[model samples]
Target: MDERFTIRAMKKEDIEEVYEIEKMSFTAPWSKESLYYELEQNLFAKYLVVEYEGSVIGYCGLWVIMDDAQITNIAVHPDFRGRKIGEALLRFSMQLCKEMSAKRLSLEVRVSNHIAQSLYRKLGFETGGIRKNYYTDNYEDAKVMWVNLG
Candidate 1:
C-alpha cells in the first residue's frame, strides 16, 4: 500500500491495459472484444481500474441491477500481486456500488481459491451458496458469496 494508486472508472482508452491484467489474473480471461462491449454497450456495467505511476495495475468490474450488484471480475497484474491491490480495488468498487444505490453485492469464486475467499470474508462477504460446475474451464464448483451494504 506504500505505492500510490488512483481508482477510476474505466475508459475506452484503458481497455488494452485492463485486458492485459485480466489475462494475467484469470485462468479463463474475458476476450478484449467482450471487455470492450461491457464498457461500450452494457448499460449496467461499472468497470474500474487502479492506476500507479500512470499505468493500470488492477481492475474490477461489476454489474449493478437495481439494488443488487454482482462482481464480474477483480484482478491485479501478476507483478503487483500480494500487495493488497485486489482488496483495495474491490473495496473501492463496493463503495461505488453503494453510491449507485446498490443494497447488496455478490460474487462467485472458485471453491479452491482460498485466498480470494479469505479476502471476501475479510470484507464482510459470507458464503451464500454454491454453483456446481460454475467454471466451465475445469468444471470447478463456485462458492457464491454476498454482502449487504446496509
Candidate 2:
C-alpha cells in the first residue's frame, strides 16, 4: 500500500462519496439511507473506507454475528480499479473479523464476476454454493464463497 492510501472506519460524512463508488461499481447500488442505517442502526455491521490522496476511493461493509462474518458489500471507484485497493480492503476486513472472534468469513458474488471470484480464491475462499436468481437487476445467480479464519 502507498503512503497516500489509508483505510479507516467509515464515518457518517463519508456516505456520499462511498455511495458514488457503489453506484459506479454495482448494477443495484445501495441507497444513502441504507448506508446510514448500516452505520447508525445496525449493531452487527462494520464499514470501512479506503482513501487515497485524501479522497474516498473505496469502501467495504461487514456483518459479524457470533462466530460468522459476511462481507455485505465492497467496491472501489471505477477509476481506481486494477490497483489492488480492493484486495487490501478485503484483507483488512478479514483481519477485522478475526479480531472480532469470527471463525469464518463469507460473501456472495455475481457468478459472472470472475475477477472478483479470483481475488476471493487468492485469499483462500472457496465456492460453497450458488443462489439462483440472487441479483434483482438481471436475475444473475450468485456464487457463495467462504473461508475459515480459525
Candidate 3:
C-alpha cells in the first residue's frame, strides 16, 4: 500500500477521475450522467474513492436497499492494478455496509472475470446464482455473489 494513498467518500468533483478509472477498468463503463445522478439524486447510493496524493485512483459504489447492500461498481486505475487497491476498496465498502445496518452485501461480476471472482471469494463472497447475458455490451453472463454480514 502506498503511504500517500487514502480512501474517502467520493465527491461531486471526482466525477472525471471516476470516469477515467471506469473507462480503463471496464469494457462497458457507466456514463458520466449515471455517476452524476448517483452523486446528486440517489439517496441509497454510497460511493468511495481512493486518492493517491490527492488524485483519485480508484472508486466503488454501493446501493443500500432495505437490509442489503448491492455493490454497483468497483474499479481501479490500470496503472494501479495489482497494488491491492481493489481489495482495500472492497473492505471499506463492506465496513460501510455493516455500518449502514446491511445484513448482506451482494454484487454481480461478469462470468469471464475469473480474477475478480477469485478476489471476491477470498473476501468471503459466495456464488449465489447466475444471470444469463447480464452484460449487454458483450453478452457476458454474470455470476451473482453474496456475503453475509450477520
Best candidate (score: lDDT): 2
| Residue-level lDDT tens digits of model 2 in 16-49 | 9999999999999999999999999999999999
Q: Which digits, one per residue and each the tens of the lDDT, describe model 3 over residues 1-150? A: 667889999999999999998988888999999999998899999999999988999999999988999999999998999989999889989999999999999999999899999999999999999999999898899999999987
Could you tell me which 10 consecutive residues in candidate 1 have the lowest summed lDDT?
1-10
Candidate 1 off by > 4 Å: none
Clashing residue pairs in candidate 3 are none
Please report, in order, the local distance difference test score of every candidate based on alpha carbons. 0.93, 0.97, 0.94
For candidate 3, the per-residue lDDT at 38 reads 97
Indicate whether candidate 1 or candidate 3 has the larger TM-score.
3
Say which prediction, candidate 1 or candidate 3, comes out ahead on lDDT: 3
Off by over 4 Å in 3: none
Q: 38, model 2: CA deviation in Å?
A: 0.2
**Candidate ordering by TM-score (highest first):** 2, 3, 1
Off by over 4 Å in 2: none
The alpha-carbon deviation from the true structure for residue 76 of candidate 3, after best TM-score superposition, in angstroms, is: 0.3
Model 1 earns a TM-score of 0.97
Clashes of each: 0, 0, 0
Compose the digit string of candidate 1's lDDT tens values, residues 1-150: 655888888999999999888888788999999999999999999899999999999888899999999999998998889988888888888899999999999999999999999999999999999999999789999999999998
